[model samples]
Target: MSTRTETDSMGAIEVPSKAYWGAQTQRSKENFAIGHQPMPLAVVHALAHIKKAAARVNANLGELPTDIAQLIEQAADEVIAGELDQHFPLTVWQTGSGTQTNMNVNEVIAGRANEISGQTRGGKSPVHPNDHVNRAQSSNDCFPTAMHIAVLQAVTLHLTPAIKTLRDGIDQQAKRYEKLVKTGRTHMMDATPVTFGQELSAFVAQLDYAQTAIDNSLPAVCELAQGGTAVGTGLNSSPGFAEAIAKELAQLTELPLRSAPNKFAALAGHEPLVTLSGAIKTLAVTLMKLANDLRLLGSGPRAGLAEVHLPANEPGSSIMPGKVNPTQCEALSMLACQVIGNDTTISIAASQGHLQLNVFKPVIVHNLLESIELLADGCVNFQKQCIAGMTANEQQMAAHLENGLMLVTALNRHIGYDNAAKIAKKAYEDNQTLRQAALDLGLVTDEQFSQWVRPEDMLQPE
Candidate 1:
């Protein structure tokens, strides 16, 4: 490939002629050949938003020339539109502070801006990366600010809506099964009678509570760390730079973003992200339980519980004849496990913040974004493939309900607890119905047993 020499503070390097990144980006790319997990484009777009807002704010404050600021804004807009995606090649494993990725964005925007202004892409002539594009900002602040913006947008625009869609779909299933009475299990054994609708509604309630927790954790994520340049002193930044930039970013992203009240804490501690991760983890746990329950309820057609029929998206076995599996639920459960693991990574990374800055910002944000995307996509896929087409096995449910020993629970208030237990034991021992056992044991008349052992009556309080 053709190459061009690009210069930065650390001398010069040969960059791909077609590439828009500069010397620092090239150096970082060559040095950190660790993993293939590239920095999230969401974060890159967020950084572009920050640079555009910063440029406009700097120009308005008379800190940067209007033409230069406009050029940076144009390039940043292109990045935000994903026109320059190939230019940002840094990985998440580079520089935990995310400085390399930040510079990669800065360099790409500068090179593109320079090219737009009738200059070559290598040299920082018409639009220097640092002075013109990244003016009045430090990687320390820009990275965390970008992290917050990316996470906030992703959760708001993707994860939350996906969760709502799935929750609503499950709720519809619940309503459809509301009157279908089934046997309930406790400790993996028959316990009592419940409507299939009630069982599914519990999943709906869990999702609602988890989504509320995720929503509640977002306001803190809206606090940006942009103006806390270097070490949070706002040393070289103009007086109103922080507030002005926050306002500009809010307008650009249509989020209720604001400058952090304590720049020091914003730069040093990533408590907001940790809190959001915890909430996402809770959602993952809820999803895990829901998926497992669905899997169990839909376990088999002949050999297992088979209380419900999951969508048979694909054939389950290669050797077995005519079998299907709960692939969507399995996939969703695995994704939940991954998100839960990502939460652990985020928690550990967040706790490593030393004095003025957290060097684990990249890992923290990477795991957080990964969890959000996984959950969002997982929910959509599970809803479309599994929950939307799920059906209740009403006949099987009724059969289970009729055969359950726990229905003897209904006889407690009438025949006394000891008599009820004796009747249940006798029925189980003789493989007889509760009414027959009660009649044989002389515990109650058939009419009395019928009146006392109604499963539907036991569904609610007397």
Candidate 2:
């Protein structure tokens, strides 16, 4: 490939001729060959938004030239539109402060701006990367600000809607099964009779609670640390720069973003992200339980619970001739596990902010974004592929309900607990029905037994 020399404070390096990144970006790309996981494009696009907002703010403050600022704004627009995606090639494992990725964005925007002004890409002549593109900011402030923007937008635009879609789908299924009674289980054993609708409603409630928790954590995430340049002192930044830039960003992204009240706390720690991750983790736990319950209820067509039938999306085993599997449930459960694990990583990373900055920004944002995307995509798939097509096995549920010894629970108030226990034990040990057992035990007459032991009557309170 053709190459061109680009210069930074360190020195000059040979960058690909077609690449828009400068020397620092090239150095980072070459220096950190750690892993294949590139910095999230969401973060890169967020950085572009920051740069665009910063340019407009800087020009309004008369700190930057208008022509130069306009060029930078246009370049930033391209980046935000994903037109310059290939230019940001830094890995997440580079600098702890995400300085490299920040500079990568700066270099790309500068190069593209220069090109727009009929200048070459390598040198920062018409639009210097640091002075023009990144005027009132440091990587410390810019990266965290970008992290917050990316996470907030993703959760609101993607995850929230996906959760609601799945929740609504499950709710429709619940209504359809409202009158379909089935045997309820506790401790993996039969307990009593319950309507299938009531059981599924529990999952709906869990998702509702989880979505509320996630929504509550967002106001804190909306607080941006943009003006806390370097050590949160706002050293080179002009007065009102923080608030002005926040206004610009809010206008650009259509979010309720505002400058953080305490720039020190915003830069030095990541409490908001930790709180959000905890909420997401709670959601993961809820999804895990829901998926597991569905898997168990839909376990077997012949030998297992078979109380509900999951959509047969794929074959269960490679060699099995006629086995269908709960693949969507398994997939959703696995995604939940991954999100739960990501929460642990985010928590530990959030705690490691030593002095005036949390150096673990990249990893924290990477994991958080990954969890959000996984959950959003997983919910959509589970809803469309599994929950949408799911059907209740009423015949199997009714048979199980009739065979359950726990139905004897209904006889307690009439015959007393001791008598009820005696009838249940006799029915199990002697292989007799509850009615026959009650007759032989002489607990109640046939007419009374019929009145006292109805499964449908046991569904609600007496």
Candidate 3:
């Protein structure tokens, strides 16, 4: 885009004659055919933050003479406000060099700046967009900074709120269904009695711990590598410029942002990215566990243990009529698996950061942003479809609890272990109820038996 105002002589169908990203966009379109899910919104947020910070910095310095800087700022504001999306063109796929993306941002900003100045589309003269606006910055620092800023922004804006909604729904259910008895299962077999609320409360605990795990990493998330320049040496940056720029970014983003203590380490490796990715993977683990529970609880209306019912999203099958599937639960499980896999990609990519800079940024951002987006979307859907609509089947729960062989646990408290074993075995063989067999053998008096068989007492142990 910083080149000429035209497309590559040989690339995709000509959609528009105007050019800013110039031949790079055309070349990218022709080369990488990766599907368009759109660049991550975190990436968008980051770019906007860059524009805002630049404009504010220029304002503070009051030295930028041309109207171009101000105009580029306005265009960036439009992009942030959800307008002019077509203009932010660049393929998600490119060579690891990031030339296409850097040029893409540079040209778009420069051209829009030119437009504001009533100049030609490809002109950068009056303000020299890259020189004046992107002054003292490098793609290496900006992209990684954007990645951190974007992730932190999402955790604050979207992920945290969604997780709260999810946790609150389950927490309410835990309290609401605390009195409802259900058959607890382990290894796909009925184990003992438990309150349906208690089982749900376990998931609530998982969500809480996961929330804590993510929240605990906020400090690391806030630390940034903005001053790292091309290789973290603070190369052309002035003394305190890094700090001032970081402060400007913090003000613009409203995040607790800071410059990294060791710019060298920040640039030479991506350990922080790997750590954050692991945190995200931990969240996926929590979600997968929650989804598995919901799926199991909603397993069957007929043959399976239907302890809780989930809202039917659609006709479960085209061929099998009258069957409903746990679509939301399934989606969450799938997303969790994908996120876990994304973390692996992130880990590998971050670890492979060669000597000075990592060429793996595009891939790292791709995986990290995608993982976060899925997490946000999945949590919102899971809360709405699965958790909100889930209902405790009190009758089914009571029946399962009453009919299970786990009631033998109560017999052990009343009679000796040997006597309880004998009673359970005889009841199994005789096809008689534990109470009936107990009465026949006098292992428990009828009054004692009537007093001791409370499921609540069995689960809570007094």
Clashing pairs in 1: none
* Model 1 weakest lDDT span, ten residues long: 450-459
- C-alpha positional error of residue 287 in candidate 2 after TM-score superposition, expressed in Å: 1.1
Measured by lDDT, the strongest candidate is 2
Model 2 lDDT, residue 159, Cα: 95
Residue by residue across 177-218, what tens digits does model 1's lDDT show?
888888999999999898989998998999999999998998
Name model 3 segments beyond 4 Å from true. Answer: 1-16, 23-38, 55-68
Go through the candidates in order and give the C-alpha RMSD of each one to the true structure. Answer: 0.8, 0.8, 3.3
Q: Candidate 1 at 454: error in angstroms?
A: 1.2
Tens-digit lDDT track for model 3 on 150-267?
A: 7888788888888888889889989998888888889888777888889889888888887887788778767777767788877765566667778988887889998888876766
Clashing pairs in 2: none
Off by over 4 Å in 1: none
- Model 1: how far residue 306 lies from native, Å: 0.8
The CA lDDT at 456 in model 1 is 83
- lDDT (CA) per prediction: 0.92, 0.93, 0.74
**Which model is ahead, 1 or 3, in terms of TM-score?**
1
